[model samples]
Target: MSLTSVEALTQVRARTLALVAHLDDADLERQVDPLMSPLVWDLAHIAAYEDLWLVHRYAGEALLHPDLAARYDAFETPRSVRGEIELLDAPGAREYLRDVRDRTLQAINGRGPDGVLHEMVARHELQHTETMRQAMRLGGLLAPGEPHLDPLTGPDGWLDVPAGAFAMGAPDGAFSYDNERPRHDVEVGAFRIARRPVTNGTWLSFTEGGGYQRREWWSDEGWAWKEDYDITHCPDAEAGHPDAPVCHVSWFEADAFARWSGGRLPTEAEWERAATWSQGTDPLQAVGQVWEWTSSWFGGYPGFVAHPYREYSEVFFGRSYRVLRGGSWATDSRLATTTFRNWDLPQRRQIFAGVRLAADPEVN
Candidate 1:
């Protein structure tokens, strides 16, 4: 059954609230990392976005609180400086969110479905839910009750993705970010990819074998990043247990580890092919264990066009960022689809990032 716009919005809003229910006032206000917004900021931002898009843009209503436009404008204030901004306290933030949601829901009910804006807000909130979860995990304040990925129970081996042309991006008919557009065909040569993400135990071996100390396994840029950051091992290796996928790894680190294992990070095309393969029995597991790094740079697809949320994809189409596929444990399952494209700077390590090995068919 298709979900009515109101139902979808309510479901996603409930999930957003549930993710923050366990946090205390202090937890809500704390900025866990330089890269992530504080929980309170995120809370207000969700409401702010809903009001901005749904209430103001879709329903033709005036802004509930005009003062909030600049306060919660993410594009204006960088994450590093959010804590210093005069954000609402926990109670105030909740009150503001309640107000915005109340007004937005009233408009939705009165006006009926407002086309794709409802779904757009729902997806936006869901993405922030994952961001908040990552902040909680990084802060060591994550509630134990949150959902987790299942253990690596799938068959242990590499899956051979045959050499051929395959449909590469999200086709028309679904709501996908602009970067996943045009549904073009991509020619990928036969390659083998592990069924699961690289685990902490595997990464530990790399560290013990001097993976970080040796420059041969790393690209010149990667080696510089490693040295500049003084990264000797996975940032959270001591915290994450051995069997878990390593988290807080940069693309450079992921690249070095793949090379050290006599493999390489899969290109975006190979990763997507393995993920979307339908020819044989499905052979992937623990896809949401972590955001697996890919060799591809973040760029516009052929004939790419900006969607309604222009900055969502257009702002990052360059060599400055590398692509990541799949999703992390913090990701909402709805946003963790095969066609979703996530990218970050190669030097960023705070997010729930990890690696999956891929190799040429002959090498395997």
Candidate 2:
């Protein structure tokens, strides 16, 4: 039998709690950069979302602890402050996450999955997972250590996929955000995509090679951002490390680099096909390696409809944000679904963002 609702949630919560345990108090509240959040804020935000969705929204119950509501408001959008979010002590926050998860499971058990709250909790967790990954990257938590292929490691070789028509989007029974609605079919010609994302070493080569200085390599808009930001980094403009996933770049930046290298960003169709339609029995599932920026916009699929999470995708459907596929190392493993979509402004890169090359090999 498949895992029960409570069992599934419990397991995921346990894993997330462990991931948070790795950071010290100083790391938890460090926000030296504007693009990243204090890790303490992450903890508080997850608990607050759980309380909002599971307890109040779903069960018609009050918040687990009523006094914490004000703290939630300050966390919705990214902040530039660089100090302790004093309300969220490390030891206390972990205990709160556990209590919230356990009580949510109890509520689910009592309700027998009859209400909408179960699915809401699941979706909320997915968002937190993505945010957590970004925080980890900013904190320098992903320092090279393991053999595991993180977003920062490009595979030594390529993974070639044969041409075929693969079903895309979320199927029924699995709760998906509105953005993943109107499941459709598209043909994907055989193509080779990097098994991992572009690494720091490789990206550094582009910078050292005057990839940024040469207008020939940049698109018109990309050149504008380069000039506007005054990014003359033959040595160090200090955006991020050579080994860290390159964040805070515009689509134009990614596009220019891809073009200079004889490749281009993957279209949304190509990206989803690669991610959701993997070969063999294992379905495409790469949640916490890297957040891949796709050529697709955040617009709805063919037959889109709004859902309860109104702002989830609707607010940023246009060119304001580019589409990002896959979750990053800081992401919660359980929060990701093949159909999940995350987006951010093209120029903002304080997250676990990176790119992998995709192109027509015959032409190359």
TM-score of 2: 0.77
TM-score of 1: 0.95
Per-prediction tally of clashes: 0, 3
Candidate 2: misplaced stretches above 4 Å?
Answer: 65-67, 73-88, 91-95, 114-116, 141-166, 187-201, 232-250, 275-288, 332-337, 360-364
Candidate number achieving the greatest lDDT relative to the actual structure: 1
lDDT of predicted model 1? 0.85
Q: Which ten residues in a row have the lowest lDDT in candidate 1?
A: 145-154
Candidate 2: Cα lDDT at 91: 72
Misplaced by over 4 Å in model 1 are 145-150
By TM-score, who's the top model here?
1
